[model samples]
Target: WDLVCDSQSLTSVAKFVFMAGMMVGGILGGHLSDRFGRRFMLRWCYLQVAIVGTCAALAPTFLVYCSLRFLSGIAAMNLITNTIMLIAEWATHRFQAMGITLGMCTSGIAFMTLAGLAFAIRDWHILQLVVSVPHFVIFLTSSWLLESARWLIINNKPEEGLKELRKAAHRSGMKNARDTLTLEILQSTMKKELEAAQKKKPPCELLHMPNICKRISLLSFTRFANFMAYFGLNLNVQHLGNNVFLLQTLFGAVILLANCVVPWALKYMKHRASQMLLMFLLAICLLAIVLVLQEVQMLREVLATLGLGASSLANTLAFAHGNEVIPTIIRARAMRINATFANTAGALAPLMIILSVYSPPLPWIIYGVFPFISGFAFLLLPETRNKPLLDTIQDEKNERKDSREPKQEGPSMKVTQF
Candidate 1:
């Protein structure tokens, strides 16, 4: 479109503006979700994206198309951020990461399959329209959805939250809803809240605390690294073979299969161990890809594609884990922070591809470094296995310090019981 309108020079700016919109959207959506409710904001997110994306499909000029794309990015982030929040709320403690990751992977699977369909139809705009249609359906679901239980409980709405939980239990046919709900603890918490009413401060006033700020800042950077590495690998996967598109398609298929299996593994395996182990495996596969890329021209592409799937596992985990760490008020912000970094990495990936013309697999070398660094980051994070997500920075800070130590079962760690 830029070329068609003889304004191709604006493409770079347009592209960044499109991404910048998401950055702004991430921050704003986070704030909005905190101020409003997750369900309400999620509906707005879908409405914004569906309407904007449709306009983008019918845009008459390059500038107009770029504007619509920018709008779509903002709206799209809202939808994804809400979805992350929803999946986290909906999942059992044991399978939180797996549930969220598998669900996010479903997005990748959907987009790839859409591309496959677009290949057959051969109309880019129509394919886009097809993709945006799902958002409208999601908007309907959002209408029927409940707000996050944690958020509801913290805000003094346990009765409302419990009602929602019973609805979910009935829908899922769980016989004992209240017995299993985190809301039971929250109900206990109300008495504590009354006792501590004068002593406790609000989030806005308390956010200025140095310890609180420092921990959240550290969390945000870690999230940034995870997203950067995740998207870096995804964007670089397109560079693996002589037929980049085919390689992407193949990995897309593997991603779908992996998504189907990953949830069950996460339920049993837990997040930290699965993430660390998978990153280690991804690093090994990448080293193999680098070695094979030097000599095996005929099959290196297929081998490299396999290695690409290894990195995707970490990407899936990060999306889920981001939601776990932050409280409901800041959940969207935290998720968006990760997404913002992914977008940055995605934007930089094209430049890496351009540089790779001078040197093939230079991008792969850089891409491979991501999972390795992520593996190291895994060492610092505590295991959230079977633990409910902390709803405040204070809760996280005291979680390990105050809790009783787990009983030793054997010489081996329990994290990899799966």
Candidate 2:
């Protein structure tokens, strides 16, 4: 593993392989979760990560390590995608954003924890083992996790869905859940959604609908920009400070803070606006980092930290907004499309970092430009704040139409003498 002067490029190649695995995972995992169930996919991913990630730590050669890391990346992506979807689907509308934010914040916590672990455990193998072992515990306890009722109902497993709901209700202290939450009641309440689910639309239908297609395109672009900037900054951290651990910890702290601020920020601002503002802030930070004189090392660190926080905020908002806006039936697929864009950026980020060695500001300039344009592009998308999750393509279309149609004055000025 002498990834030095001769094999420096191999480091980037390893990271690229890992991100490629994420891309593959998102594509396959989304389809599987949509066809199977969120809980099942989540459980499977947990076990995969526990086993494969551990093997990565014990890999005998660079090739073996990269291959295992690729597999680990797949499980990691599936775990994250399904975990966020499950949390969003199960939580009450009022808590949906918060729930998603909480799920994401764990990564921030892990980053901080890893900083400490890496500082104490200088052995890379031991550090990897330390991080990978916990997933085994998670996988063991994941058996109790309930499947998403929305997924079950939409997938035409109403009986199983109903059983899950009853269990949820009972756990929430509703003693009469068994009597009150019958299949008839559930079917009647979600009648339109049930009918829509039975239609069994292909994933290609997402591209066929103009409104959804546009939404997905814009979202994917934004995701690409965000990840490229975010990870580019992350990989460049070694250049910012002498103590990489300190910088890593500070980055993690800022990310955690940014995520914590999102639920509150969403309460006051529309999702589109919030994302736009964060992306713009991120652009400013990245561009400013390039402007700062190399002699003033402290200012560079400050700007980098701010950029990291801004990118983290925008990234979290992207996921939350994407879930809220996309219809339930196609949420996972749409998200995977966006995730593909994200992982592509992730794969390219290290390559971009390589550009820094040739001309230090070149990478930041490229990263800054993407988000700057994406910030303004966000204005085109609709706001999803406080809205009920749309369950079908028709529902999304109807909602868009309703938002566009002019509202008539109740009785005061309605077509007088028309």
Total colliding residue pairs, candidate 2? 0
Looking at model 2, report the run of 10 residues with the lowest lDDT sum: 409-418
lDDT (C-alpha, whole model) for all candidates: 0.65, 0.87
The TM-score measured for candidate 2 stands at 0.88
Query: What TM-score would each prediction reach against the true structure?
Result: 0.69, 0.88
Worst lDDT run of 10 residues, candidate 1, spans: 2-11
Clashes of each: 0, 0
Q: Predict model 2's lDDT versus the native.
A: 0.87
Per-residue lDDT of candidate 2, residues 312-387 (tens digit)? 9888878878888888888767877898899889878878867766897998899999999999878888888988
List CA RMSD, all candidates.
Answer: 6.5, 3.7
Which portions of model 1 show Cα errors greater than 4 Å?
2-19, 90-102, 137-142, 147-223, 236-238, 242-245, 260-274, 280-300, 318-343, 357-362, 381-418
lDDT tens digits by residue: candidate 1, 1-418: 5353444335445555666677667767776876687888888888888888878888888778878888887877777777787787778877776677666677657647755775676786887788777778877876777777656655667788777878887788998776776665657856664344325455575366554444355455544544444454455553455655566677777677666666666568777778777777776666567677444654766665565565566566655565565554445444555566666655554444444556766766666676677677666666676778777667766775665666557756556646
C-alpha lDDT (0 to 100) for residue 248 of candidate 2: 92
